[model samples]
Structure formats: structure tokens, C-alpha cells
Target chain A: MTFQLIVFYSFAAWLIFSALMVITSKNSVKAALFLVLTFASAAAIWLLLEAEFLALSLIVVYVGAVMVLLLFVVMMLDIDYAALRQGFVNKLPIAIVTSLAFFGLLYYFITHGEFGPQNYANPAPKGADYSNIKELGRILYTDYFIAFETAAVILLVAIIAAIALTFRGRKHRKAQVISKQLEANKKNRLKIVSMEASIEETENSGEQEPSTAEEKS
Target chain B: MTSSVNFSIISAEIFLLVALCVIMIVDLFQRDKERKLTFLLTQLSLVSLFVMGAQDLGLERQVGYSEHWIKDQFSTVLKLAIYLGTFVALLYARPFIRERNLMRGEYYLLTLFSVLGMMIMVSANSLLVVYLGLELLSLSLYALVALQRDSNIASESAVKYFVMGGLASGFLLYGISLVYGMTGTIIISEIASYLSANQANLMIQFGLVFIVVGIAFKFGAAPFHMWLPDIYHGSPSSITAYISSVPKIAAFGMAFRILESSFGEADIHWTPMIMICAMLSIVLGNIVALVQTNLKRMLSYSAIAHIGYFLLGLSIGNDEAYSASMFYIIVYALMTIAGFGIIIFMSSENKDYQQISDLRGMGRFHPWYALMFTLIMVSMAGIPPFIGFWPKLEIFRLLIADGQVLAAVVAIAFSVIGLVYYLKVVKEMFFVDCEDSPKVSNSRSLKIALSINCMLLLVFGLMPDSIYQYCISAFASLN
Candidate 1:
């Protein structure tokens, strides 16, 4: 029990420290990395609470997909960091006050509120045969089916939105028209000569047959 | 609370989803010249959705899909409004898009998807479902706002919208998490019952505050309204027509669903914050609009003020007040669509006529169009004998009924100030004249559509009893 408490406290401390670093980091990329660390620590805490599904998802989804996306955006956009920092001093007092108030309230609740070991006893350990993913799947497919489908639809919309934003059509650019090329038929490319054989013009001009026919006519 | 999910209850959503996919596929084969076919298909889908929603009306409200989805008369009304509003907006968008060479299939497809998102939002019963729907809607909107890719302003607006929208959604998710932790439920109805059975906690109140901030941002209420004006001005006016009207109705539905349904018992905790936002929006929206020359930006501010009035009704927190707010949003949407529709009609080719001076001498040349514009402006100004007057009157009536005399007076005073800018639009059309006569678009269909839209405002103004009653009944059936 003491060991468990030590692990929980350590993870919680790490989570808070990384979260603070996520905000206070000077570089945007560093901030994003710190955010990932914060998420990882939070997942560790969730695992300790027996929320295996949430812990795995917190690592897989946030650290895997969302953080990567954030990193891409941060790298893509050339942000003027100097301009961002310029207002920090001017806004410092209000920011500090608001954040302190928020922290104080949170601390008060955690320390004084009716939230303690009595309300949140350690969850029973699962049997060796137990599977958290299977439980999640069961609930998701049955009770939360609509929610799951809605989430899928949101993902689809995000994909569509990304494509729409990035897709550019340049009409003037030179590209192979394979379909148009393949659609050229014999009637369009070749015509049968129904006139008499203009042998003299053919020998002298070695020119196109259509031109020879027109000249002969 | 049933374990088995009923598929028939959400038939409209299913149909919409299938139709959107089919439209996207069909649009792939259509060339630029044949884009009208895509437009017609989209419109047909919208009309069918409206019919489906209409047929579902007056049915018993049912919660299905393990209570994460709901089908109620209130959602039905809001969904129907969204469908009808989109239909009108797309009809107005057609000529403008064609002239600007923006008749891409993606536009229609994205719009249909966004509408689907809105429908989901209106019917969502769980906070998670609500977040998903809101994200879908906003993601599509961010792309739509940046559709004019070459324009720097459009790109800038899209970026701003994305960042602000992301921040708001974060706040909302945090609030949802806190609420879930407090009550051990994510379903709105269950949350309501839970809160009613217990005393409100500080954690829940904090969650409610964040939720209120998120809602205010979505509604473009003051202090959180920085994104609204720029987005309105930067987007193509066709998209502006959609963004300015349909989404507001959807937002109101979302607010009602979350606040009145889930947090109804905790109203006292959230009311003061909402009241402050309402007051600030009204005071700032009208006062800032007075100095704007860009017609779209002015209307954007006017939208903020209108939300202020809508929030006024919400703050009162009664059946009468909820209905009044509903009626106001519907009325406001109608007037706004017509207002932006005229702007769309005036735009020829890529040259958008959105400035106040663009309407100069238009009254002399196109008397009928000008008259339509006049009616819309007067309605927006909250003048008598127009539809806008009724909703405002209803709000004020409810305010007075609830013994909020100070709120009523303050709202009335701001609205009077709002009248000056609305009249300025009319004055630009009539009193001012330019030497060069701007050519009026000869699209008879758009003219006819705008005329009908404007006439409905006046007609409904004259006979608001039925509509008002409909609204009252819709809210009365809410759990």
C-alpha cells in the first residue's frame, strides 16, 4: 500500500511539472513535447487507477495522433515568437492573478472537499483472465454504439476538411491527358483516299496525303 | 433508458448521411459546366430532409441509442429550421458561386456535411456526442471560410477561427470532464436528475462557468466575439450567408439542450455569468456597429446584439422565455438570410458589393429589390409591423413578466441604439445616390426567393401567434 501511494504521488508530481513546462517552454516545439510528456504521465496515473482502456487511449490517441498533428502545425507555420513574448509582461499580472485563483480553488477542492479515500477506494484488481479492451468494446458496441458512430463521423469530417483545405487545382499546369489521348479514334486520325492516285505529286512532294489531295483537287 | 436502440427515430440523420455520401461520389464525375446537377441533387436532399423532419413532428419524444441520442419535438423543430435555412442559403449561393468560379463540388459536399453535423448537434443527448457534432461542424466551417484560398484575408480568418474554436472546444471538454466526475453521468437528462437530487458542488459550478464561456464563444457574444466580424468579412458572401444564419440557430439549439436540459436545475449558478455576457454583447455590439462602413461587419455586430437578446430570453429561464428566445432566433435567421441574400444578388462576377456605398442609387434603379431590402432593414431595426418586432417584444414581455425590469430597460435602450445603424443601411439605399448605376442581377429566381423571404418576415410579423404558439409547444414538451 505504501509503494502504491509512492508511485501515485510521483506520477502526479511528474504530470504537474510537465504540464507547467508545457505552458512555460520558450520554444513551441519544446512546449509540444512537454505536453506529450504530461499526457504520458497522466496516462500512467490512469493506469494506476485501473482505467486501462483510458490509459492506453490517452497515450495512443493524444501522444500518437494529436501531438503529431500539433508538431506538424508548429513546424509548418513560421510563428514570430518575439511578438508573442512582447505582451507577456503587460499581461503578466492579470494572468498570474487568474491562474492563482484557479489553482487555489482546485487545491481547496482536493484538500477539503468530500473527495477522499472514503469516496474513491482503490478499485478491485481484475482477475488474470480479465481484458479491459474487451470490456470497452462491449460497452462501445452496445450501450455507446451511437456515440462511437458519431465519433467516426467526426473523424470522417476532419479528413474531408483537411483534403478540402489543402487541395489546389491548377488548371494551367501541363499534365498528361491520358483519357483524351486514348479517346482518339481512327476516324479522327485517318481518312481513306477515295480519289485517283496522284502519283506525280506523291513522288515530287513526299508530303502529307491530305495536302496532296487538296492540291490535286 | 432502454437497452435496445431504435433506428427509426433517427431516420432523417441516416438518410442525410447516405445522401451526403452519394452526393460526394456523384459530384466526382461532374465537370464544372455540369455542377448545376450537383447543386440540384443537394437541394433535393435538403427538401427530402425537411419533409422527413416535418413528418416526424408531433410524435412522442423518445430517447434512444442508450439515451445518447434523442428524438423530440424540440429537436425536430430545430432540425427543420436548419434544413429550411440551408435550402434558402444554397439557393442564394448559386449565382454568386457560379460567377466567382467557385462552383466546386466540394463546396456543396462540405455544406451538406456541415448540415449533418448541425442535425447531430441538435439531437445530441450526451456531452460527448455534442462535442463530436460541434467539432464536425466547426472543422467544415474552417475549411469553408478559407475556400477563397488566394485571398490572404480569408486564410487569416480561417486560421483565427481554427485557433479560437479549438480553445473553446478545449474549455468545453474540460467542463464536460469535470461535470462527469461530479455526477458520474454524461447523458444530459441523467445529469439533470442527478443535480436535482443533490446540491451543486463548486467543481460542478466551475464546470458550468467553462461551459458558459464556450457557449458564449460559439454564439459570438461579446469579449469572445473577436472571431465573428473578421470571419464574416473575409469569407465569400455565399458562405457568409450560411455562417451568419444557420449556425446561430444550431448554436441556440445546442445551448438549450445543454443548459436547459442538463443544467436546468443549476441555473442559478450559470445565470449571472450569462447575464453579464448578454449585457456586454448588447452594449458593445450596437455601439461598435454604429461606426462600421462594411455592411457584412455591421451585420456581424448586429448578430452579436441579436444573440444578446436571445440570451436575455435564456437568462429569464422559463417556458415563456425559452419560447421567446426560440422565436427570436428563428425570426432573426430569416431576416439575416434575406439581408445577406441581397448582398449575394448584388455581387456580379467576382466583384462583391458589400460596402454601404454599393447600395447607393440602387433604390432608384431597382425599386422592388430596394423595397425588399428596406423591409429587411426595418425588421432588423426592430421597427413595428415587421417580424423582428414580435420576437423582441416577446423577449421584453417575458423580461417584464419575470420582474426583470432593469434588464428590459437596458435591452430596450441598446436596441434603440441598434436602430440607428440599421437605418443607416436604408438611408444608404434611398437617400444616397451614385452617378454610375450598378447593374442589378437579373436572376429572376433569386429575386423571387428574396421576395418570398422578405415577405415572410412581414407576414409572420402580422400573424406571429401561430409561430409563437408553435415555439411554446416545442419547449413545453422538453423534459
Candidate 2:
């Protein structure tokens, strides 16, 4: 009946509905749109859970970046929704059974579980001046320094990997072979010749060559 | 800032990182002339790292960086193996990469980065550190697999490896989060304490399943090994050699840290799942490998079977078995490097030597190369008086000693099934004849390195006690 409870229920409903729509929607684009909706609702739920930093990251990382990528891929591929859905009906029964069983298990655990108030109590609400990002950064840089550095290394590796995998050199472009340059020497690259000239033969040959060039011209 | 960071504990890693950056910059400026320099620098860095790691071989355990990492006798032993394995792999790969014009700076740089990742993983004492190190290694490997951009198969394999690797990472991260949730800590020592106190937690059991799945995928055990063959076959043999050696040692390090240290208390629960996976992997890896004509793919399957054998040690769930597993993985890494080294040495620019048929008349034409390959294959087949026999024998010895008779029997049976393919390689080398004889590697260094590598296998086979005692002492230090 309270406002927070109402907000939670509505967001929870929208999250579930959008998630189901993401899978069941016949159109791929629509499914992507529904996935966006699902992510947004999940972020809102995370907000309700007082994980403000996580909520914002979900929106920024998942919705802003990843969803756009998914949309681009879906639009570009021109995938046939009909073909994709061909076996859906045949696989539906087992899917339904598995999901229903999962749901039952979840429900049982949630309602009748050993995890209670003692193990997990509601965290105290933060003050208006508290900054989740600041607190997170403080712990991350200090206590978890190695983990932070490892993450940086992982991201660097990822960037290098992406470049290595996709970037092929263009052909027919003038490229330098440094080894060749390093190996080059005057003896190999150029020749200087000195010879005693046979003046009469040189003159006759030069004259014949010019006359042939003139005839061709 | 809880404790002052011990810079010396990670000195080798620091040295490698600095060398990596320096090489990258040098390569960038030198442009066309940087290939050989980069290769030399990478080798230099690895040698220095080996020296650095060797210096601390008998040092007392040092836990630093907020206990997220540790350097002990165990880690030092494994780090030396990684460095040595990688050095040999790169040495053998030089001729192959040079012939194929795949000698780019990125090839060597990415490998160094992955080596750094492996070092980190080997020393990790926290789940968070383990995950990050794994990601670093996986990302680098994905790139290395696709270094041959002109080949569509390489690109396809890269994509497949990336996606599957991402999925395995997700599984691993989820499991870590679950374990964190249950234990309220991420440190391995703390997690072990918590697990001992709360052994009945179903959530911990769930987390263990996911962790095992991730480990299985990394080890390329059955049911999670779909990407292994395709990646191995599609990758250039040079990259294949590097990957097949260093990564297995790193994975063993990770298994030791995560499973043996963090979740040791819940062995009864995890042992059964691991046993089933081991059995399936052995049966599947051997039987399927029997039909593979592509040498690389056959080796990948054999690698999987070896993984199953490695897991046999873990299945026994004791300290001796753990050490046996460590010894097994180290020996396996060496065997794979030598096997792939021959393949690289035989391959030329135009002829890839990808098929068993390509190896025809190798023995007749080049008896020395054939002799080396024969030693490698015989060792892999687990015949007596070879390095491979000792590890298998060690596994069986530990299993039978632990009263795991059925598991030992099944393992021995599968190993026999596995020997057929290794023998196939030998037979192809010795018996079969082809009209065209391929050119062998002209690099003297590669030939010499390979001879030493294979010779070590025999020498180690004869003197297994020294290394076996080293493994035992390292494990003993763990307690």
C-alpha cells in the first residue's frame, strides 16, 4: 500500500513482462526493444535495492552501449524471424516444463528458506550527502588495488586483441621494409663505371639510335 | 594500504611488464625493422624472468599486496615451467612464423602479455585476482588465434573461442559472486575457513558446480571442449605451440589456488562431479581422437585426454594427488610443446604440413627430426622410460594408493585407447611414404632446441625422482 512497495511491484511486473516479450516477440527488432525495456526495469529494481552505482552502470553499459550494438547487428543481419521461430513450437513444451519447474523451486526457496532476517537484514538507508561512487573508488583503489590493476591489464589485452583480430593490412599500398633498408648499401644499390671510350663506335651507335627514334616518332 | 606492498614478490611480473611496454614502443618507432628486435627482446625478457623466478626457488612463502597474491616454492616452480615452456615454444616457432610472414610485433607482444597473465594467475590468492588474470590470458589467446587474418578459418575460430571464452568467464564470475555471497569474502584462505564452517550450504554447492564448469572449459575437458579442436587446427602452428604449453601450466596453478585452497573443505561434494567429467573426458577424448586426420585436431583431442588424466589426481582428493596433478600438467605442457615443435619445424611457407600424410617419409628423409618426433610421440603414448610414462604412472600410483581402484582402471584403459593416435603419428613418420618430401626448418637454433627438449623428456624419464621430490616438497610447503 505504501509508495515504495507500489513502485517495486510495478517495476517488477514491467521487468518480467518485458523479459518475456524479449524472447517471445516474433520480430527481432521488437525483441531488442523489449530487451532494452527489460534492462531499464532491472536498473530501476537495482535502484530499489540501494545499489545506486550498479544501477547506473547497468544503464550506461548494458542499455547505452550493448543494446545499441545488439540493435545494429539485428538490423544489419536481416535475419529471418520465421526461420528462427520454426522449431519454437516443437521445443516449447520442454521449455515450458523446465521454466515452470524453475519457478516452483524459486518460489519454494523464497517462501520456505533458512535464509532469514538474521542472515540478511535490510541495510540502513544512506544519507543525502553520501556518494556511492566515492565510497566504491576508495575501497577499489586501496583494499582491492591488485584486482583493479588486473582489470586494467585485462582491458588493455582486450583492446590489443580486438585490433589484432580484425585489422588486416591493405594491399598495393607502399610499405617500408626496414630490413631491406638496413641491408641496403652503395654496392648493391648503385654502380659507378669508368671505361676508355671507343669514340668512333660510340658516335656511330648514338647516331643510329637517334635516327631510329626519329623514324618511330 | 593495510600492509606495505612487497615489490620484490612480483619482481618478475614487473620486469616483464616494463619490457613489454619498451618493446611495444620500440616496435612502433622502428616500423619495418622491428620484427627481429621484438622477437629478441621478448626472448630476453623471458630469460630474465626465468632468472628472477629461479632466484626465489627455495625462498620462504611471501604473501603481499593485501594477500591477493602469494609467491612461494609452489608458485616459483610453476612459474619456471611456464617461462621455460614459453621460451622453448617461441624458439621453435621462430622459423615457422618467419617463413609464413607472421612475425609481427603483436604476435610476440600478445604472447608476453599472456605470459604475464599466467604469472598473475599462478600467484593469485583471491578469486577476483584469478578471474582478472584468466580474462587477460583468454583475451590475448583469442587474438593470437586470429593472427592469421587472411585465413577465414582462423577468423571463425577466433570468434568461436572469444564467445565460448566469454561464456566460461561468465560462469566463473557468477560462481565467484555466489561464493562471495555465501562466505562474505573473496580471499581464498578466508573462503576456505568459511566453507569449513558452513559446509552444508546449498549455495556453496551451486557455486562449486559453476567453478568446476569453468575449470573444465579451461582445461578442455569433455562436454566443455568443443572449441579446443577448432581453435587448435585453425591457429597457425606457432601460436598453437605457445598456447598448448604455457596456458595448461597456468590453469593448473589456478586449479590449485581455487579448488585446493579455497574449496578444499567441500571435496566430497565436488569430487564426484570431477570424477564423472574426468571419466567422460578420457573416454571421449581418446575415442574421438582415433579418427582425426588433421594432426593439430588430433593433438587437441589428445590434449583433452591428458586433461582427463590430470584430473584423475584431483579426483583422488589428497595432497599427494594434488602434487601428482601438478607434475602431470607440467610434463604434459612439455610434451605438447615438443610435439608441436616438430610440426612447426617441418612446415614450410607453402606447405603447412597440417595432415598426417604431410609427415609421410619424414623418418626416411630426415631421421633426426623423425627421431625427435618419435621420442615425443612415444613419451605421449606413455611407454616406459619416457617423461610421459612417469606422470601417468604417478597418477595411477596415487589413485591405486588412495584405494581408487575403479577410477585407476578406467584411466589406464582410456590411456591405452589414447596410445593408438600417438602411435599413428609415429607410424606416419616411420612407415608411410609420399612422393614429395617437404622441406624441414632451416633454423639451426630450432633444431638444437627441439633436440634438447626431447632429450630432457628421456633424461627426466630416467631421473624422475629429482622432479618428483621437488613437486612433493612444493606441496608440502603448501601446508
Candidate 3:
């Protein structure tokens, strides 16, 4: 009846439709795209619920960053879409049974007894400056501070560990050993000789005298 | 803005943040040339955290930051256990990390961060705090599971964990919002008070069920435990040890805070649900674990069963049950750490030592390590004269006291079933012989740390009264 209710229902319906499509779509890429739609519509619902920060984050993080990456990866991979669908017939019975059971349970839960509609006395106006982002930030920095830090540390560790694990050393090849290189010295390669020149001159003079005597004979 | 800051309430966070920054700096400048220095710094930080947690042991329950968080004896004890457990895990991880050339600043930093998250989860007094802590733990784990990036198995496990973990978080947040809408409050204590005054509200009950499902999933209870085996088997053995031991303590702490602190008034609704989950987890965990060939995967399922036992204590929904659960978590953590430590010791860079056959001839080749591992396995199986026995005894005693004989019997039967799989590990270690012996090598530090860890299990098994008394006092404060 109200404009707000109309908008809410529209987004909610779209969300449900998209989610269903995500499950039922035969093509993997179509299913992924449907999931993106579901995420967007859910963000709209979050906005209606006055969780603006969460709604924006859902769009920015899930749809913008994560989904885009997923789309790229999915597109790049050489997957057999038809092969995946082959099991659909075999799984149909189980799927239908599960859906029916879930629906029945949900119906029982909702209709078996009346959960009195919660009424707050003098409820605040729908948009009475409720900034979810600000409150979330405050809560996170104060009460949930330890958890926030821990998350950062965990991420850091994962990054480091990933790099370390991947950075394998080259397997046993005959590369020059550092110890062998360091052990090499000038004494091992070169020898300074002072008597070598005098011995060479004496050998040359004896050779010349022998040749001269031979020629005179 | 300044009024929002509560130094005492956020002291644990501050300590961890400072420690993380200091470790980061030390890691950057300290150079890998002096690896011992980095190790010393890490150990020092962890020990100081343990001491800080110990100091808060006798403190009265105090709410800070507008009742968004509370610190009490139960949290303090659990935090102490987690810190100590993580410290021991880190000590065990060090040798393995070095051997695999995986030693880096991030590993220690991430571990410290994960511990910090556990501390927050233990002390959380609000759903928002709970979610924050849970996400912190979950995100860290996603990365930690994928820490060994070169291993395809690790990457696959990480992807599975990430997807499932995101879904679980979404469930938790939605449940929180639903409860918030029904109660008009996000603070857990307020929600409990509101629910007490307004019982039989179907919406509130529905929200509570969703929350419990989320919690159960986080604990890797049945029907939501698909990720545990893959993650455990895929991660490095040391990380698996860390994952199996420390997070369970955090999970228990979270369950206590949510089930008891917030939903105490909704006992009629939640208790039955928890009982069903507990029974399911026990039956499913034990039955499925019987067929697992991978040691890590088997241990993962066994951990699920242990959670069921812990839940049995929780489902009793009394002070005695709470203490019993706490006791169970502590002992379970120790036994799991010791068991996984042996695996880490046996694992090499190329080999994971995850399969039962990998441990064959361990008794003949490395008799002492095998003996210690056997002791750990027997204790894990809940055999007598080990620390694991006390938690089981406590849980059964509480169950009997609470007049739940059938559930207690079920728990005991599952415990026996659990022992079968654990004994398979022992069987492989001792009875089975290998034609080619695989040598087991460990550093002196690792040997010393593991000796202390296993020795403490025996010591505590013999003398559980001291810890039991402490748990009693903690629960008394809770009441």
C-alpha cells in the first residue's frame, strides 16, 4: 500500500527470482550471472533494512570485486558445461524431495502457531539518521578491536605462507657450492718465483755454446 | 567519540595489536639470519599474553563499551587455554615450518591474530562482536588453509572453505538481524532479558534456530561438516594441528556465550535443538570417520565427534554442564595438539605423512616418538589415566546427574567407536612393519615441547581436580 512497501516487495521478488535462476540455469555462466543479480537485489533489500553500509559493501565487494574475478576465472577455464548437466536427471528426485521437505518444514514453522508481531512502543522513524556504517566502525574499533586485528594478522600470514610455500629451491643440480668458491685462494692458482729467471738464462747460454762448437767441427 | 573508548574492556585487543606490530617490525629488521631471535620474540609475545589472561582469572564479570563486550572468569579461563594451546601449537609448528622452508613473519603474525580473534570471541557480549570474531577466525582460516599455495590440494581446500565460510557468515548475520528486529536490541544480555519477558515468540524462536545452525556449522557439527576433512587433509600437517586444536576452543567459547548468555531464557527451544545436533554429530562423525584413510581427515571427523561430546555437556544447560564443556575443550585441545604434533614431526617436504601407511614401521624405527604418539592416540580415544578421560567422565557424570542416561550412553558408545579409528593409527604405528624404514627427525626444542605437552596430559589426567575446581569457580561466577 505504501511506496516503501512496494519497493521492498519488488526487490525481494527480484532477489528470489534471481536466486532460483542461479540454481536452475543450465549454463554455468548464466548461473553465475544470475547469482550476481541475486547479490545486487539482496543489497537493495539490505538498503531497505537501513543497513546502508552493508548494502554498499555487498555491491562493492561481492559484485564489484569478487564476482568480477570469479567471472574472469570462469570464462578463462576450459570447462565442459554439458558434462556437468548429465547428472541432473539422476539428482532430480533428491532435489525435488529436499525442496518439498524444506517447504513443508517452513510452512509448519510459520503457520502451526502465531508468533505475535513484534511492536515497539514509539518506534523511531524509518530514516531517523541511523548510520549503520558509523555504528559498525565504532563497535569494530572498540569492542571488536581484537578480532579486527586478528583478521589482519591472519591475512598477512596467509600471504607470507603462500609465497614461502611456492618459492621452492632448485632441485639437486651441480651448481657451484658457496663453500667451494670461498675456499679458493691465490696460493692455489699462482706461484711467485725469483730463481726461475736465473735458471732460464743459464739454460739458454749452455744451449748457445753447444751449437757454436758443433758448427766449427 | 572519546567516550566510546574503554581501555580495560579492550585491553586484550590492545595487547594483541601491539604484539602484532612489534612482531612485524622485528620480522622485518631482525633478518632471517637470526631465526632464533624471531622465535624468541614470538614465544615471548605468546607467553606474555598467557600471563595477561591469567591475571584476569579472578576478575569479576565486567561489561565495557556499552555492554557490547564482557569479560568474565569463563572467558579468561578459555582465553588462557587458547593462548597456551596456540603457544604449544606454535612451538610444534616451528620445526615443521623450518624443515619445509616455510618460516616467515606472516605465519607467526597470522597465528597471533587468530588467537586474538579467539580471545574476542570468548569475551563477546553482543551478536555483532560474535560475528566480528567469527569472521576474523574464518577469514584467517581460509588463508591459513591455503597457506601452502603450491599444493593444489591446499588451494582447493581453501576455495571450498571460503565459499562455505562466507555462506555461514551470511546465515549468522541474517539471524542476528532477525533477532534484532524481533527484540529491538543487539546486545546479547538485553536480548536474553527481553526473551525471558516475552517467551513463546515464534519469530524469536525461528531466529534462534538460525543462529544455532550458524553456530553448529562453525563448530563443524554434522550436516555442516563437509569442509573440515578437505581443509584438514589439504593444509600442512602443522597448520592442521593448529586448526584442529585452537579453533575448537574458540568455537566452544562462542557456543557458551551465544547459547547460555543470550538464549538462556529460550532453553525450551534451544536445548532440544542442541541435543539433536549433538546426537547427529556423534553418530555421523563416528560412522563416517571409520572409513577415512587419510589421518588428517580421520582426525577432523574425530574432532567433530568431540564437539558432539562437548555439545552434550552444553545441552545439559546448567552450571555443571558449562564447566564440563570447558573442561572437555581444554583436554580435547591438548590431546589433539599432541597427536598432530607427531604427524608434523613425521612429515617431510615431499611427504605429508597423512595416510596410515606412511606411519608404518614407526615403532621399529623411532620407538620413542611412536610411543609418545601411541600415548596421545590412546588418550584421544578416551582410554583411562590420560587427560582425555577426565572430560568424558565429567560429561557423563554431569549427564547422569542431569538424568539423561540415554544421551550419556550414546555419547559413551560413540567414544568407543571413536577409539576404534584412533587405535588404527596406533596399529599402523606399532603393529604394521615397512620394508623400507622412514626415519623420523625432530629438533631438540620440538622434542622438549612435545614431551611437556604429552606429559601434562598424563599429569592432568591423574590430577584433574585442580582444573576442575577452577572450572567450578568460573561457572559459579557465571551463575
What's the TM-score of chain B for every model shown?
0.98, 0.97, 0.96
- Error at B310, model 3, angstroms: 1.3
Best-fitting candidate, measured by TM-score?
Answer: 2
Order of quality (DockQ):
2, 1, 3
Encode model 3's per-residue lDDT on B197-311: one tens digit a residue. Answer: 8874777777888888888888888778888888777778889898888998898888888888888988988998888888998999898899999877788888888888888
Chain A (candidate 3) TM-score to true chain A: 0.68
Residue A122, model 2, lDDT: 73
Docking class of 3: incorrect
The reply for model 2, stretches above 4 Å from the true place, is: A1-50, A55-107, A114-118, A170-217, B432-436
- After TM-score superposition, what is the CA distance of residue B308 in candidate 2 from its true location, in Å? 1.9
Error of 2 at A26 (Å): 11
User: Which runs of model 1 end up more than 4 angstroms from their true locations?
Assistant: A1-111, A170-217
Question: Which pairs, if any, clash in model 2?
Answer: none
lDDT (Cα, tens digit) per residue for candidate 2, span B1-479:
76648888888888888898899888877656328788888999999988888788888988888889899999999989899998888888888877675778888889999999999999998999988888889889988888888778878888898899998888888988888977889999999888777764888889889999999888888889898998888888888888877899999899889988998888887888888888888999999999999888898899989999999888888889888988888899999999888888878776777787788888888888888889998999899899899989989998999898988998899889888898998898888877667678788898899999999999999998867777787888887
Q: How far is B63's C-alpha from truth in model 1 (Å)?
A: 0.6
Q: CAPRI verdict on model 1?
A: acceptable
**Model 3: residues with Cα > 4 Å off, grouped in runs:** A1-217, B1-4, B433-436
Q: How high is the TM-score of chain A in each model?
A: 0.63, 0.74, 0.68
Candidate structures ordered by lDDT, highest first: 1, 2, 3
Q: What local lDDT score does residue B126 receive in model 2, on the 0 to 100 scale?
A: 94
Candidate 1 lDDT at A99 equals 95
